[model samples]
Target: MKAKYLVLSFFFFTAGTLFSQNKSVPKSIIKQNASILKFYDKKELQSMQKGQLLVLYVERTKTLIKTLPYIALASKPGVTMVDLGIPFTSENISLLDTQHDATDKFLDITTEFQKGMLPYSDKESLIKAILFYESVLKQMHELNEQE
Candidate 1:
């Protein structure tokens, strides 16, 4: 009886330890974090080169924003990490859920100008888009200054 009790206790203790050690963050959060980091790469930000890099940045930003939902969904229970035997805490999952919603709002604001003035072929539309982007940059700069 004593030996059986010892074995049962040992099994329970090992299981508890394993379950408590699950600190894996969801893959969605990890993916977004990586893209955000790459989007803010120092070399790209610091480079003097203008037109090409600016276009590339805008495209990349749009793509990343579009991907947030899919990435966030990829971490559903029994989907990615859970299926692989890696576990994540509820706190981390909730944080990512909130962040993903915020990302949608950010994308809407960031693309407001483009969405308003789509199909920019004519000279006037082109000029308007340019002015819109300039205004956005000005506002962003002011916000940074305030911070």
Candidate 2:
């Protein structure tokens, strides 16, 4: 009986340890995160005019707004937006409409994102969409300072 109890305890402990291990983040997500960091450099964004950034932001946000629901539905649960190496948050998303005429569209994207939408089919596309959003926000801030 003592030997049987020891075996059972060992089995349970080993099983729990195996099951509780943290799953590794996918290589694609890591690569996408790196790409986003490189693409949205602060100096580069500061140099771009607000109009250019606005146009890019509006177009990419529109695409994300349209496709994010599908991506969210198809993706596994617990998948999240790749880290963009910036302070992207719900508040930042809400502020997207403050500088643009497409307020409704921006609001739509923010709502979808808040609802856990993943924004694109692949990591690369998602990275581009987020980078554009970040760049536009930076440019908008610069423009506001100038005004």
Candidate 3:
């Protein structure tokens, strides 16, 4: 009987904790839906004020983060395609090298995107392309925020 009572109390304690947590959201904020979120509309310069905006952005961007890994095409194995012969066997390459190439590709592709350098059916090419831009934004934000 005592063991049963203890178990029930523990369960209630855990349930209470979970309910309190769900009720009080410090980090996550919920918001209404947006009509459109396009390539150009992606730029959000305004400071976030409303809980709803935070929710929308978080949900949308969580989707984006989930999509990011899928967005990146596996780098083709070659010296010529990468063009610099940067030997990366995915073991010992430095991040600085990767950043340089990614940044260059970003600038190159932004021009290409405007001029239609790449064909249409590249399979999430645009998302991966924008990843570079987003990466830069994240880095800048982190740097400013001392992250």
Candidate 4:
């Protein structure tokens, strides 16, 4: 009899504690069905955002590429050019190196994307892609903002 009573008391105490721990959320903030999120689950929504950022990055890179001079392409094949004694300072060399690195990184990402190297499933590949895309997008945003 004592054991049964003790078990009942412990059950009631646990139930009461659990019930108290659950805080009530205000009804006003909770929508029955938000149309904006009607179709997309959290992962899909995140993937969509990453896709948008990639598109933006591609667009910006395209613009940048356009603005760059195509001097090498314009030059005739087997043509030897005389040195103009162009001065290359350390700072200028480093700046050009950094620019080339950024362009190469962007090209690498786009090439991988075009090859369908990133699997869009809710698996490890997709998660890693999402993180990579997010970081790239963040870097682009910061550079744009600075400019």
Best by lDDT: 1
Q: Give the root-mean-square deviation of each candidate in angstroms.
A: 12.7, 15.1, 18.7, 24.9
Compared with the true structure, model 1 gives a TM-score of: 0.30
Which sections of candidate 2 miss by over 4 Å?
A: 1-38, 74-147
Cα error, residue 107 of model 2, in Å, equals 11
Write the residue-wise lDDT of candidate 4 on 1-147 in tens digits.
999999999999999988884322212111122111122233653556545534433443443342233232211112111122323445544554565567667667775674474234344444454445444434433542452
Alpha carbon RMSD to native, model 4: 24.9
Higher-lDDT candidate among 1 and 3? 1
The digit string of per-residue lDDT tens for model 3 on 104-124 reads 465455545534533432424
Q: Write the per-residue lDDT of candidate 2 for residues 1-147, one digit (tens) a residue.
A: 999999999999999988894433321211111111233555554566654444445454554433333232221122233343433455544343233336445666675663454432344444455586666434433442462
* Runs in model 4 lying further than 4 Å from the true structure: 1-84, 117-147
- Cα lDDT, model 4, residue 27: 21
lDDT of 1 by residue, 53-127 (tens): 444445555554544354324322124445445456676577756776787688778767654544344434334
Highest-TM-score candidate: 1
User: For model 2, which pairs clash?
Assistant: none
TM-score of each: 0.30, 0.26, 0.22, 0.26
lDDT of 4 at 4: 100
